[model samples]
Target: MEPLAARTIPDLVRAGAVHFRDREAIVDGAVRLTYAQLGEEVNRFAAALAARGVGKGDRVALWAPNSWRWIVAALGIVTAGGVLVPLNTRFKGAEAGYILRRGGARLLLVEDGFLGNRYVESLTAAAETHESGTSDLPDIVTFDQWEEFVGGGAASGGAAGPDVTVTPDDLSDLFFTSGTTGQPKGAMLTHRQSTELYVTWSALAGLVEGDRYLLVNPCFNTFGYKAGVIACLLRGATVVPQAVFDVRETLEVVQRERITVLPGPPTLYTSMLDHPDRTRFDLSSLRVAVTGATTVPVVMIERLRDELKLRTVLTAYGLTESCGTATMCRPDDDPHTVATTCGTALPGVEVRVDGHTGEVLVRGYNVMRGYFEDPRATADAIDADGWLHTGDVGVLDERGYLRITDRLKDMFIVGGFNAYPAEIEQVLARHPAVAEVAVVGTPDERLGEVARAFVVTRGPADPGELTAYCKERLANYKVPREFVFVPELPRNASGKVLKTTLRSR
Candidate 1:
């Protein structure tokens, strides 16, 4: 194994080439890339980008589904000394344009079409519309075009570009927050930060060689991209990428591939648990399951262990600003602890609860370098003492486990009483008919603000009955003032409910 200081992304690929040369690195149905083949592809892509004038400090964006190309592109960009900017594939034209322009991307790689949508055509239209006369518009390249560009220059002796020396502190990836409250800002992650996060998470999760990882979540999200894909690569584990989430198909893949590790949001676990064909698949091979992006309901965790037969069901907590994952429950944690706590901070990281407001603050190599081109916001987020203020209200238990109560901004003052959305959401999630729920503070003439819940129900249920159920457990002021039933809550690509969108509606 390479030393941590010497283990760069490119180094990981090179090591895998020698250790697991012919072993499967990534599998996407009919497509499979051996470690050696993937390493060669990474080198070729890196050379192609360097030939196109992409160098150190340049930003390259990848907007596509979960595929072999995504991994190759990310590794290529990093190896070429360029910063990688992964865009959410579900972003609309406006959102995509904003990210591209904000990041000042020199190049954009995307799929021709996915899920029947012409992403390349749509992105071109968006670019033309947004930057009609701009000189720094990004150069668009299709997947096949990119492959040809690299393959075309094979005999030119340019496939092996000049090796650029980079330090552990050099920026490698810029992940933008999901921006549930405000506009997104890029969180800069150094090579050391990225590598440390993956290494620590893999140790905490007990991931090892030959582990088959089923990756259904969007790789654009750091949780899935770094913790799942990157971690698996470092461990010589087989990565099975899913283009999109389909419960039945996911189950089938798990059985067919003998997938051992499954990491996704709680909503995904719920969907898999509720799938009618779930019992038909042989899921005994699955040993580890991780849930993040939102709080995991205790009932859901119980069902995951009892019914799904996954022995280790862990809950993780982190943000884009944390380089992916900062804290997560270990495999040996009790079920109740796993459900209630986000686990202790990973090794070499320090987590502290604010003395006054109980806001979670983290300081470590995993913390980001700050938001790109947003010094004021960065200053507000990271304190002068170098601790990244997470803005999440939490409490550290006696055992050093951190339990997130709610987002500080999401907590509201109702009739001069504080009401936390997570507390209310947890209570509502326990209701028999509630499938999904999001609580937001809406304007109230009497009180300064009141809680309003958007709920997705599994069956017929009256709002009055739900209110009565909450009143029994929660304080009168903390109970939701109104309930709005919906088919489903608005969620981002990672399956986190967008409370900001719910509030707007």
Candidate 2:
């Protein structure tokens, strides 16, 4: 096996500038930056951050869509020895504000407009209420002023502050988990854990130099940031960042850019296969594909090889706590294994399912340090034995391949986004008409599973009224698709609501 190259994100940038100089590192819309140019911009941005009193371990929140500037800002924050707080693009004002205040972010880099929403205004208004009403909240910076933000250092000869001496254990990022119960908790990950995990991931995916990678995944998620951007940087691959995923537009990009790598959930491929004009675009350049978040149909794997002409197709499984890597299907694996299992554990990771209960337990360097500011919750997740009790149930085959059977928690995926019934129920409980609520995942043809809410009402309430109330509090994806009112919820003798019964209904 090839030895891992760099130790930190900043070191990776320096290495890329030396080896891949003059090569196109990023292509976002009309902006094309060479490795050298990217390095220069990162250095200047780091300097600008240093001038603003940002230092090691300071949190910098980034609220923006997928763009070259997002990439630059993330790298710049790491280069300056600051922790990156990535806000989900789908997050509404209150959701984003809660994270910012909890993480205590000092600076917020945001996009003024995206998908017809102005984030700066929405975030500012939300912050006014949730943010302790002090000057400690992050100072917002818009994308339009991005050039000037970096130019401040360029004007000063681009000299960043004295070396901060970051070690492997230094915190790299503070990623918040999708909380199912109440408020979300930040998962603390170190520099070495993230870099090492991605190195293993890149090797497993067979990423190579000169690969034209197309990123349709959101940059906030691990799929896009760690496996997408960081992996591309490791291999000297050209990054083609697409802000949104559209079948026709993706087909155009595949032909125009001669993209060799495409990785997304099953829905992404399904959309392409179902497109009416998929035949018109030349998708011959596509060679590698990595898909898994929701379920992967065996037919989709077959179609990828036979119909789409893709040479490599892989499926894997992971969670945010595991640095988005635990197991992956190998290149030589058969279609049956690829489709049915999440493949064997990675080189250094350990995955074992309980013999009786089938709960999956993981222990490895890839596991996060712990949840920030919530030691009790962290203890609940990772026990004293060093094993992370992933609330997922699975079974290991005779050959060591792992297949997930069920979730011990009531968490479900809504179009690849993890939705927790506890969180939704907590929000819905605020409505005057809702006396009690229980949420469960129901089957959906397109999105894999959608949330169906069961409610016990105190007064007259309609589905439309309940949905409108939820829309005001949660992200669109977390909103329930159907609402069924009942006189009371079925509960076990111990007073636990029977979610299984709710799901069955």
Candidate 3:
């Protein structure tokens, strides 16, 4: 496998520009930029940021949906020696505002509109109400003003080189975790750690020169940012930026672009295979598929190979703390191994399970520096020994493959989106009618698991009313799909709510 020459994300972009100058780097709708062109744009963005007083160690947030512009903004921030704080696209205004404020971003790049929502307007309003008043908040730059923003820097005629010195250990990205308990905390990762992880990921995914990648996953997530875009840059793969995951649109892109790589949760591939019009699109170009946010059905693995005819169907296991790559299935592994286990650790990573509780623990260079500005939380996550206590219950088989059995934390994934019961319960508890509540993940046919709330109300309560209350505060996925109004919650002798009983009900 070819090795990376650059240590930082900025240097990586420059390396790609030098080696794959004329090669197409990104494709978003009508916009297509070659590596050289992308490099130029990134330089201009870096200059623009410098003009705005964004310097080393400053945080810049990207709130827009997936697009070529998003990739440019991310690289540009890193190039300018700024930490990229990516906001989730599905986040409600308050949710987005919390991340922006907590990360202390000095600049924000957001889309004016997306899927009928006025993102800029909502975020602007939310920012005003945020504890870190909008007065000191990041300058919100809309997508329509993108050209002007870029032009302002060009007109200034500032030097293309970075204004401040950048080191490998300098904070590159501050990814906020959607925690199972309490509010989100920013997980800090350095440039060296991120670049190293994705380079390994690219090789594991079998990415190579001239391959076309259909990136259906959100660019904000590690799956899209690191494995999707950065991995492509490392191996000269072309990226087709997808805003949302629509089966028809995905199939069209694959057939039209001859997309060689498509990686997402199992929901993506299953939707394609189950779609009635699946055969209408020529899917022969699909070569690599990397999946696994939740459980992987054995049949899903079988169909990816037998039905889709994909050469490589890899299942990976990771969390944001681990830079999103801890273990991954190999290309040559059998379907059963791929289906049953989240393969062995990468070359330099170590994986062990707690002998008593069976919680997976990972120790590696890929681990994040710590939770930004929250050393207490950081110490809780990474113990004294340097192993990241991955709060996940799993077992290492004789062959060293890991099969995750359960999550020690009260977090569950709904349609690949994590829904923490504590977070949801916190939102629900705010309703005047709710006296007490216990939320749990109940099995679902479509989405792997969805939130189910059992509420003990002070007065007469309506599930619809409570649902709408949560919608106002939380993302749509976090809103409980099914609400059970009960007199009291089942509890243990210690007075802790027995979530297992709630799930059994």
Candidate 4:
């Protein structure tokens, strides 16, 4: 067995075959690949990429839906010593083009059409209109075409490519955060940083060989790709990929595959909880169910464990700048703690609360190298002392648990009183008629600044009634002065609420 320290992303894939050759590595409907088979595909894809002028330090963009092909492409890109840049599948031409140009992508591999969106058409247009002088006009290839280019017709007897040696210091990926405040900047993650995070998360979650991981989140996001796909490879676990999320279909897949691990955002759990035929599906095999990207409602956590029969429910917190997961609720944590806290920092990571304002600062191997080609932003995020100021205001309880109060930038001062959106959002989520809420500070002459809430209601509830409900529990200044009812909160591709968008209105 290869030493975990010596393991790169490619090494992890090969190690899975040596340890669990017969175990399934990926299952997508009728398509199932064992560890050994998946390793072969990864190697072939590497050779294909190398043959097309992709080599050490080149950036290969993967703009596709979640599938076995996406995994193969990601591993292949890394194996060929190329930096994998996974773009959001939900991106339109303008957004996708910006990412491609920003990353200086040389090659883009995409699906034909996913979820009624013509991905191939969008990529083609983006490639043509890309205006970055530093970036090459990327070559576009459909997933089918790339497969054929590698070895669809000819016998698979091509000479094995030379080993692409990568040190821990080599950049592995460039993941862009879902720019809520400004333009998105790419977070540079080195091989060692990514591997360290994978190891820490695998150990913390108790993942093992033969575990079937059901992944529903978009692969473009660091949380989904690194935490789900990369972590599974490190632990020799199988991945059940979903091209798109459908509550009914997800339940069916879990039953049919005997899935052991399920990790996604809270919205997914809410959808599953609301499914009328949820009981009809045999979800007894589920061992660990994890949720993140937002606070998990206490009711949702309890129902998932008691009614859904999941053995454990965990919650995590992190960002693209922190290599996916920094803190994760322990398996043994009580339901109350999991609902309130984002958990402690993982091993090999250090987190501290700023003395003056209580902003969270993280320093560790899991932290990104920096924002790519943006020294100004990088300086603002990671100081000269090497600490990545996480901009999130949090505190460590006496028990060593970390409770995120709110984002420091998101905190609003209303009439000399502090207003944290997370606090108000948590209170609003408890309302029976409210599905979701986002609060932001808007300009006001009298109070200097006032809290305004945007809400998604479960039923036809009046905004004024909701405002009055808040006034009962919170101080007059803490309560939202204005409430706007919307069908949904504006969110980025990764399911994070876009406070900038809310503030813009």
Give per-model TM-scores: 0.80, 0.96, 0.97, 0.79
In terms of TM-score, how similar is model 3 to the real structure?
Answer: 0.97
lDDT values, one for every candidate = 0.79, 0.85, 0.86, 0.78
Worst-scoring 10-residue span by lDDT in model 4: 153-162
lDDT of 3 by residue, 376-466 (tens): 8899899998999888999998888999998889889888777788888887887899999999998887788999999999998888888
Give candidate 2's error at residue 83 in angstroms: 0.3
Error of 2 at 333 (Å): 1.0
Which of candidates 2 and 4 reaches a greater TM-score?
A: 2
Better of 2 and 4 by lDDT: 2
Cα RMSD to the true fold for all candidates: 10.5, 2.0, 1.8, 10.4
Task: Name model 4 segments beyond 4 Å from true.
Answer: 3-6, 123-136, 152-159, 178-181, 410-505
Residue lDDT tens for model 2, 14-129: 78987888889998878999988888888888877876778989999998888899998998898889999999887877788888888889999888788867777677666676
Worst 10 residues of 3 by lDDT: 129-138
Stretches > 4 Å off in candidate 2 = 1-3, 131-136, 155-162
TM-score of 4: 0.79
Model 1 has an lDDT value of: 0.79
- The worst-scoring run of ten residues by lDDT in candidate 2 lies at 128-137
